[model samples]
Target: MNDSRFTPVDPVDLTARLVRCPSVTPVEGGALTLLTELLEPAGFECTRVDRNGTPNLFARWGRKGANRTFGFNGHTDVVPVGDAAAWTHDPFGGEIAEGYLWGRGATDMKSGVAAFAAAAVDFVRATPPDGAVVLTITGDEEGPSKDGTIALLDWMRTKGEAMSVCLVGEPTCPDRMGEMMKIGRRGSMSVTFQAQGVQGHSAYPHRARNPLHALVRLLDRLASEPLDHGTDHFDASTLAITTIDTGNSATNVIPARAMARVNIRFNDAHSSASIAQSLRDEADRVTAETGVTFELQVDVSGESFLTPPGDFVRLVTGAVTAETGVEPVLSTSGGTSDARFVKDHCPVVEFGLVGRTMHQVDERVSVDQIRQLKSIYSRILADYFA
Candidate 1:
């Protein structure tokens, strides 16, 4: 029996309810609880796929081992609310002021989750699909992510659960609601370079090798060179020198070591291995030239991936165009999302609301966009199963 407390399917209302949960990063904060209450009543089978103390919910609205399954992926966790006093509204209040819902995760994607969840619940009730509708919501996306969607995927593989096609409800639009969808994302990696030098008095210039100088030269060379010109389906790769620190307080003394960090967002033209090799080659050249050796640390978050322009891409684009009269661009420009994990399981893409205020103070979303997004998702469901 459905819970009387969970009433009609309304994305905006559900979004407000979710935003009020305060589910920051690895915290449940009652967000997943609300989802279970709503979804279970709508005849969906729900399971708490918690792993390593992180909460994840997996819900399916059809028989297990179905021939075809469509999946929706999202995160309930939000980043911390920095400088809470700077906001015009409470960060967890979920207040609606002047046609907008004001709160953290409003655009970064409680709204996205609400839109898709509402759409799926209503769709299955109205005209049940022969296959299945699966929702994977995680509480660890904003944290280390070692146990969120990755954990769910591992569990699914063990249980023999499968999703043939998946859509990630991440905030993809930069400015407008229906302007963009991500077919792929650039690979991301970070490298930290530590250069060692002999410290000496500033007055004795030649006696000491300044690691700071060598670090700066290496950074300049890496930053000045473009990783590549734009690829056919992707933008040019980029490397950013995020920080260069010598930590030398005394002006007269050369620092014993200098440290710098660089983050690279690369397209399919390059892999982490290739980029790491390039960095090592550059460091080697600098070592030989400046007589300063470097120690490097690298972390590869995810490799670049693309779904390509095909039937599934056309299906989603056609739905977006039909609903909004806006020809959405099939873009591959964005930071990594859980879609990165889903891609290994099935073909995946991302679409959602405008992201202008995501991760910023006074984060908010238009109430109308939430409703419109629900309609778009409903249409996609209708078309995908037609």
Candidate 2:
């Protein structure tokens, strides 16, 4: 049963409660339910935005058609624990020890969800802002993400719900609590190439073509050349060949086909179409030279995006400096987050606790940082409405 008392919000307690739920990706595990129970009594209209069996929560306090809305987006789902026995503390224990909250999702990022939730609840209840405060929480962020934030955004568009500005409560700081904030993210794409050739005995010199040689040549051309130098707010694009396989069993037989896969993290210098075209061109050139036929398949996850250094960024930076005394360095150097989906709707930036232990065993967060994060979020709310 949820304790529905009208007391002040405590982020650490909220974080512990959330971490104990064991809501790994694609699992409800009562995390969303608990959030609804907590927010409903605090005078927020709560809705379950579940799509294709994935759980998402949307809550708002204040007038429905209010002219201004400040949004906070985050995920409650944590990645799975690898080798549960190796943990010093139970992955779902949510135990507080040695000045830290120990458990999975402690830093990435049930604590972040708790901090923002506690701040939003306390701020709306204590000061009662004239505008609306919106929270978009999802359970599919660590999974395929097909039915998480995207579904919420689709529902919001159909229902005419909108925000003037949005902040994603993702773990952005690399080490120190206030050292960095993500203003953008690099685009991610993966491609697989298959080279087809004739199979024959290895002893026959000119009878059979070895597709592995052609595959190696293709990968060498792609990897040996850099995609680009670093962009203004992003690092240089990187392409890594993740896999090369032929699956040939016999020692004396040349395989008929060989395949190679590459994953690319690109900056604003290119788009999915442009990169795909580049790969196709490289494959065509290799095929023309070697007489090896090729087929390529590509999947683009998200395009690179930036909100720029403007009022929203300055406001967040000033709040962080006020609370933590560290002026945050604006960066775009991390993996993708749900912020990629929200960027299309409005300007979005990411900030949260240090992420040194995000997906590792014995994942945890400093208890003090949770309180500091709450204070910073509260200040952002105050300034955004002012």
Candidate 3:
């Protein structure tokens, strides 16, 4: 038996150390620091890429412009541990019991970051690849996301650092390991509408032009139809009317203003700009019919993107299948992740542990699965550089 496999980093130990860090979104929480300590000792050129007070780390294991660079992206910061009293184990304890490692970022991703970091460190030490290995870890993925990966990529551009291809270690499997990977993601955007009208006595409805009525009409128009049938690589676009309110407490008075917010997750069939134009046109149509003025504001989180199945996709799928013996399905069904940002820099796909428990109380991951993930990542590095 080869003792070398046990000589260096154990992904499970790294995961436990990370889970113990109190890094809730937008907080450094020492998670990045711990990772930097581990990587630097193993030969990674580590740099703290903090932006606008958001913590981020970028580490590379070889020359900057190696023939081909394989990049990794993940986040160490986690969502807040909601209702700590509701958990059976200490949320920050990183307990290894009952065959699972329990903690806040266990499934949602600290384990993922650890797995890849360990794999990168070990793979480089054991057999130096001709190409480079880069890891980008961020602390603001769970927050506004403006200063996290975006900041890293912006910095990379300014410094002329780039990856030939990138893999995001976000948990993409829903039911079990090796069952799924994300090939693309739907774009996300939000639109808020404010309507103005004349306020008057509710008793004589004819005397008042109620803004609430106009707002409701506008919302209905936006939500009344399907954005599209499912695309070849994505599900149909969806628009959800998240909120509508006027703050009116009196029954006898008609309010002069009302507001509503709608969120849309769109496929490659549309862009945020196109959707924004269509929505503004809808508001105009409603205003023409209702005689009320409307103001529309749009915020786009990310544009829809796809890394068409090719060599990169095949390499990832083959690795997961070889490790877990389950031929994985290529999917783009989940909510947004850092991959949405990585696609611009390089062709990116996501694979990792089962995420059924991500963001839930008592969130935990199987210990064996963590090791298995490390093996999978190790194999990917080997094959990509093979």
Write model 2 residue lDDT over 23-97, tens digit each, in one string.
998998889998888899899999999999999999999886689899999999989999999999999999999
For each candidate in the order shown, give its overall lDDT on alpha carbons. Answer: 0.92, 0.93, 0.92
Which stretches of candidate 1 lie above 4 Å from their native place? 1-8
How many residue pairs clash in each candidate at the backbone level?
Answer: 0, 0, 0
lDDT value for candidate 2? 0.93
> 371 in model 1: Cα distance from truth in Å?
0.7
Weakest 10 consecutive residues of candidate 2 by summed lDDT: 1-10
Candidate 2: deviation at residue 347, Å? 0.3
Q: Can you write out model 1's per-residue Cα lDDT over 1-386, one digit (the tens) per residue?
A: 23345445989999999999999989999999999999998899999999989999999999888988889999999999999999999999999999999999999899999999999998888788899999999999989988999999998999889898998989888887779999999999999999998899999969999898899889999989899997988999999889888888998999889999999999999989999999999999999999889999999899999999898899889988888889899999988898888999999999898989999999999999999899989989989998
Candidate 2 residue spans exceeding 4 A from truth: 1-6
RMSD of 2: 2.7
